[model samples]
Target: MIKPTPNPPELDDTTPYEFPGSKRFHEAAERALDHYLKPNALTLRFHKPSTMFQIAPDQDNESLLAHACESLASASIMTSDIAAYVDNPQRHTILAIQQIIMLAELAVNRVLDNVEMARSASHN
Candidate 1:
Protein backbone atom coordinates (compact mmCIF):
# COMPACT_ATOMS: atom_id res chain seq x y z
CA MET A 1 0.00 0.00 0.00
CA ILE A 2 1.09 3.61 -0.67
CA LYS A 3 0.51 6.71 1.38
CA PRO A 4 0.04 10.28 0.20
CA THR A 5 2.95 12.67 0.75
CA PRO A 6 2.61 16.05 2.37
CA ASN A 7 3.66 19.11 0.41
CA PRO A 8 7.15 20.12 1.50
CA PRO A 9 7.23 23.78 2.46
CA GLU A 10 10.96 23.93 1.63
CA LEU A 11 10.20 22.81 -1.89
CA ASP A 12 7.34 25.27 -2.27
CA ASP A 13 8.01 28.27 -4.51
CA THR A 14 11.61 27.20 -4.86
CA THR A 15 13.48 26.55 -8.03
CA PRO A 16 15.31 23.26 -8.29
CA TYR A 17 19.05 23.45 -7.81
CA GLU A 18 20.79 23.86 -11.15
CA PHE A 19 24.23 22.53 -10.43
CA PRO A 20 27.04 22.72 -12.96
CA GLY A 21 27.04 19.70 -15.30
CA SER A 22 23.26 19.92 -15.26
CA LYS A 23 23.06 18.67 -18.84
CA ARG A 24 25.20 15.59 -18.29
CA PHE A 25 23.45 15.18 -14.94
CA HIS A 26 20.09 15.20 -16.68
CA GLU A 27 21.33 12.74 -19.29
CA ALA A 28 22.39 10.40 -16.52
CA ALA A 29 19.04 10.92 -14.84
CA GLU A 30 17.27 10.06 -18.08
CA ARG A 31 19.39 6.95 -18.42
CA ALA A 32 18.48 6.00 -14.88
CA LEU A 33 14.80 6.66 -15.53
CA ASP A 34 14.84 4.63 -18.70
CA HIS A 35 16.57 1.80 -16.91
CA TYR A 36 15.27 1.52 -13.34
CA LEU A 37 12.47 4.04 -13.09
CA LYS A 38 10.41 2.53 -15.91
CA PRO A 39 11.34 -1.04 -15.14
CA ASN A 40 10.68 -0.80 -11.39
CA ALA A 41 8.03 1.92 -11.44
CA LEU A 42 9.73 3.74 -8.60
CA THR A 43 7.59 6.60 -7.30
CA LEU A 44 8.55 9.73 -5.43
CA ARG A 45 7.06 9.22 -2.00
CA PHE A 46 7.86 12.22 0.16
CA HIS A 47 7.86 11.87 3.93
CA LYS A 48 5.42 13.34 6.40
CA PRO A 49 6.03 14.01 10.09
CA SER A 50 3.77 11.24 11.23
CA THR A 51 5.32 8.69 8.91
CA MET A 52 8.91 9.98 8.71
CA PHE A 53 10.20 7.71 11.47
CA GLN A 54 7.20 5.48 11.83
CA ILE A 55 7.87 1.80 12.62
CA ALA A 56 6.48 -1.28 14.33
CA PRO A 57 7.03 -1.33 18.08
CA ASP A 58 8.92 -4.56 18.74
CA GLN A 59 11.88 -3.88 16.42
CA ASP A 60 10.66 -0.47 15.44
CA ASN A 61 13.42 0.83 13.14
CA GLU A 62 14.88 -2.53 12.06
CA SER A 63 13.24 -2.63 8.65
CA LEU A 64 14.51 0.77 7.59
CA LEU A 65 17.95 0.11 9.04
CA ALA A 66 18.14 -3.26 7.31
CA HIS A 67 17.18 -1.70 4.00
CA ALA A 68 20.09 0.75 4.27
CA CYS A 69 22.52 -2.01 5.24
CA GLU A 70 21.41 -4.15 2.32
CA SER A 71 21.89 -1.22 -0.03
CA LEU A 72 25.48 -0.80 1.13
CA ALA A 73 26.11 -4.50 0.68
CA SER A 74 24.76 -4.36 -2.86
CA ALA A 75 26.96 -1.37 -3.68
CA SER A 76 30.05 -3.15 -2.36
CA ILE A 77 29.31 -6.16 -4.55
CA MET A 78 28.81 -3.96 -7.62
CA THR A 79 31.98 -2.04 -6.89
CA SER A 80 34.00 -5.24 -6.93
CA ASP A 81 32.63 -6.00 -10.41
CA ILE A 82 33.45 -2.49 -11.65
CA ALA A 83 36.93 -2.61 -10.18
CA ALA A 84 37.74 -5.75 -12.15
CA TYR A 85 39.98 -4.81 -15.12
CA VAL A 86 41.78 -8.11 -15.72
CA ASP A 87 41.41 -8.44 -19.51
CA ASN A 88 43.03 -5.60 -21.52
CA PRO A 89 43.80 -3.62 -18.40
CA GLN A 90 44.17 -0.56 -20.60
CA ARG A 91 44.80 2.74 -18.83
CA HIS A 92 41.81 4.25 -20.60
CA THR A 93 39.39 1.66 -19.27
CA ILE A 94 40.68 2.19 -15.75
CA LEU A 95 40.34 5.97 -16.18
CA ALA A 96 36.84 5.52 -17.56
CA ILE A 97 35.90 3.41 -14.57
CA GLN A 98 37.26 6.12 -12.29
CA GLN A 99 35.14 8.70 -14.02
CA ILE A 100 32.12 6.46 -13.69
CA ILE A 101 32.82 6.03 -10.02
CA MET A 102 33.16 9.80 -9.60
CA LEU A 103 29.84 10.36 -11.34
CA ALA A 104 28.23 7.72 -9.16
CA GLU A 105 29.59 9.49 -6.09
CA LEU A 106 28.17 12.76 -7.34
CA ALA A 107 24.79 11.10 -7.81
CA VAL A 108 24.98 9.76 -4.27
CA ASN A 109 25.80 13.24 -3.01
CA ARG A 110 22.79 14.69 -4.80
CA VAL A 111 20.56 12.03 -3.25
CA LEU A 112 22.01 12.68 0.20
CA ASP A 113 21.49 16.39 -0.27
CA ASN A 114 17.83 15.79 -0.95
CA VAL A 115 17.62 13.49 2.06
CA GLU A 116 19.31 16.05 4.28
CA MET A 117 16.88 18.71 3.15
CA ALA A 118 13.96 16.46 4.00
CA ARG A 119 15.47 15.64 7.39
CA SER A 120 16.13 19.28 8.24
CA ALA A 121 12.64 20.27 7.17
CA SER A 122 11.17 17.49 9.26
CA HIS A 123 12.90 18.91 12.31
CA ASN A 124 11.06 22.20 11.88
Candidate 2:
Protein backbone atom coordinates (compact mmCIF):
# COMPACT_ATOMS: atom_id res chain seq x y z
CA MET A 1 0.00 0.00 0.00
CA ILE A 2 1.72 3.26 -1.24
CA LYS A 3 0.99 6.58 0.54
CA PRO A 4 0.05 9.77 -1.42
CA THR A 5 2.67 11.98 0.37
CA PRO A 6 6.26 10.75 0.91
CA ASN A 7 8.12 11.05 4.28
CA PRO A 8 9.56 14.53 5.06
CA PRO A 9 13.30 15.19 4.64
CA GLU A 10 15.50 14.86 7.79
CA LEU A 11 17.15 18.17 8.77
CA ASP A 12 19.71 19.29 11.47
CA ASP A 13 17.92 20.51 14.64
CA THR A 14 20.42 23.35 15.36
CA THR A 15 19.13 26.89 14.80
CA PRO A 16 21.16 30.03 13.89
CA TYR A 17 20.70 31.41 17.44
CA GLU A 18 22.59 28.38 18.86
CA PHE A 19 25.91 29.06 17.00
CA PRO A 20 28.82 31.60 17.24
CA GLY A 21 28.63 34.00 20.28
CA SER A 22 25.15 32.65 21.20
CA LYS A 23 26.56 30.73 24.19
CA ARG A 24 27.28 34.08 25.90
CA PHE A 25 23.90 35.40 24.72
CA HIS A 26 22.15 32.23 25.99
CA GLU A 27 23.89 32.65 29.40
CA ALA A 28 22.89 36.31 29.53
CA ALA A 29 19.26 35.41 28.71
CA GLU A 30 19.22 32.74 31.43
CA ARG A 31 20.72 35.18 33.97
CA ALA A 32 18.12 37.81 33.01
CA LEU A 33 15.30 35.25 33.40
CA ASP A 34 16.65 34.01 36.77
CA HIS A 35 17.03 37.58 38.06
CA TYR A 36 13.34 38.25 37.37
CA LEU A 37 12.05 34.76 38.33
CA LYS A 38 14.11 33.75 41.39
CA PRO A 39 13.59 35.30 44.83
CA ASN A 40 17.00 36.52 46.03
CA ALA A 41 17.86 36.05 49.75
CA LEU A 42 19.88 39.29 49.81
CA THR A 43 16.84 41.23 48.52
CA LEU A 44 14.56 39.51 51.10
CA ARG A 45 16.93 40.37 53.97
CA PHE A 46 17.08 44.06 52.97
CA HIS A 47 13.39 44.43 52.02
CA LYS A 48 11.58 47.54 53.24
CA PRO A 49 9.56 47.15 56.45
CA SER A 50 6.02 48.46 56.98
CA THR A 51 6.07 52.23 57.30
CA MET A 52 2.90 52.43 59.44
CA PHE A 53 4.33 50.61 62.50
CA GLN A 54 7.92 49.99 63.57
CA ILE A 55 9.93 49.66 66.78
CA ALA A 56 12.92 51.92 67.33
CA PRO A 57 16.21 50.30 66.31
CA ASP A 58 17.95 51.79 69.37
CA GLN A 59 15.40 50.30 71.87
CA ASP A 60 16.95 48.01 74.49
CA ASN A 61 15.83 44.34 74.92
CA GLU A 62 14.88 44.76 78.61
CA SER A 63 12.49 47.65 77.89
CA LEU A 64 10.98 45.79 74.91
CA LEU A 65 10.41 42.56 76.92
CA ALA A 66 8.96 44.57 79.84
CA HIS A 67 6.49 46.27 77.50
CA ALA A 68 5.58 42.89 75.97
CA CYS A 69 4.88 41.39 79.43
CA GLU A 70 2.65 44.34 80.37
CA SER A 71 0.80 44.12 77.04
CA LEU A 72 0.17 40.37 77.48
CA ALA A 73 -1.03 40.91 81.07
CA SER A 74 -3.48 43.59 79.91
CA ALA A 75 -4.70 41.32 77.10
CA SER A 76 -5.32 38.51 79.58
CA ILE A 77 -7.36 40.83 81.79
CA MET A 78 -9.35 42.13 78.83
CA THR A 79 -10.20 38.60 77.61
CA SER A 80 -11.40 37.60 81.11
CA ASP A 81 -13.52 40.75 81.28
CA ILE A 82 -15.04 39.96 77.87
CA ALA A 83 -15.67 36.36 78.96
CA ALA A 84 -17.90 37.62 81.79
CA TYR A 85 -20.19 39.46 79.30
CA VAL A 86 -20.61 36.61 76.76
CA ASP A 87 -22.80 33.41 76.50
CA ASN A 88 -21.68 30.01 77.85
CA PRO A 89 -19.93 28.70 74.68
CA GLN A 90 -18.47 32.14 73.83
CA ARG A 91 -17.36 32.49 77.44
CA HIS A 92 -15.53 29.18 77.21
CA THR A 93 -13.81 30.34 74.03
CA ILE A 94 -12.85 33.68 75.61
CA LEU A 95 -11.59 31.89 78.71
CA ALA A 96 -9.46 29.59 76.55
CA ILE A 97 -8.03 32.66 74.77
CA GLN A 98 -7.42 34.31 78.17
CA GLN A 99 -5.51 31.21 79.30
CA ILE A 100 -3.27 31.45 76.22
CA ILE A 101 -2.64 35.15 76.96
CA MET A 102 -1.88 34.35 80.60
CA LEU A 103 0.63 31.67 79.52
CA ALA A 104 2.29 34.21 77.19
CA GLU A 105 2.42 36.77 80.03
CA LEU A 106 4.09 34.21 82.33
CA ALA A 107 6.68 33.40 79.64
CA VAL A 108 7.37 37.11 79.10
CA ASN A 109 7.70 37.62 82.88
CA ARG A 110 10.31 34.84 83.00
CA VAL A 111 12.25 36.43 80.13
CA LEU A 112 12.08 39.83 81.87
CA ASP A 113 13.44 38.26 85.05
CA ASN A 114 16.26 36.60 83.10
CA VAL A 115 17.21 39.90 81.43
CA GLU A 116 17.29 41.67 84.81
CA MET A 117 19.45 38.89 86.30
CA ALA A 118 21.90 39.04 83.39
CA ARG A 119 22.23 42.81 83.73
CA SER A 120 22.83 42.52 87.49
CA ALA A 121 25.35 39.72 86.98
CA SER A 122 27.26 41.85 84.45
CA HIS A 123 27.27 44.82 86.87
CA ASN A 124 28.75 42.79 89.76
Best by lDDT: 2
Worst 10 residues of 1 by lDDT: 39-48
In candidate 1, how many clashes are counted? 0
Q: Which whole-number lDDT from 0 to 100 does residue 25 have in model 2? A: 93
Q: For each candidate, how many residue pairs have backbone atoms clashing (under 3 Å)? A: 0, 0
TM-score per prediction, in order, is 0.31, 0.60
Per-residue CA lDDT of model 2 for 26-89, tens digit only, reads 8899999999998799998999878788899999988998899889989998998998899999
Give the runs in model 1 whose Cα sits over 4 Å from its true position: 1-89
Candidate 1 colliding pairs: none
Question: Candidate 1's residue-wise lDDT over 18-84, tens digit each?
Answer: 6768767888889988887564433435433466666556763434444554565566556556567
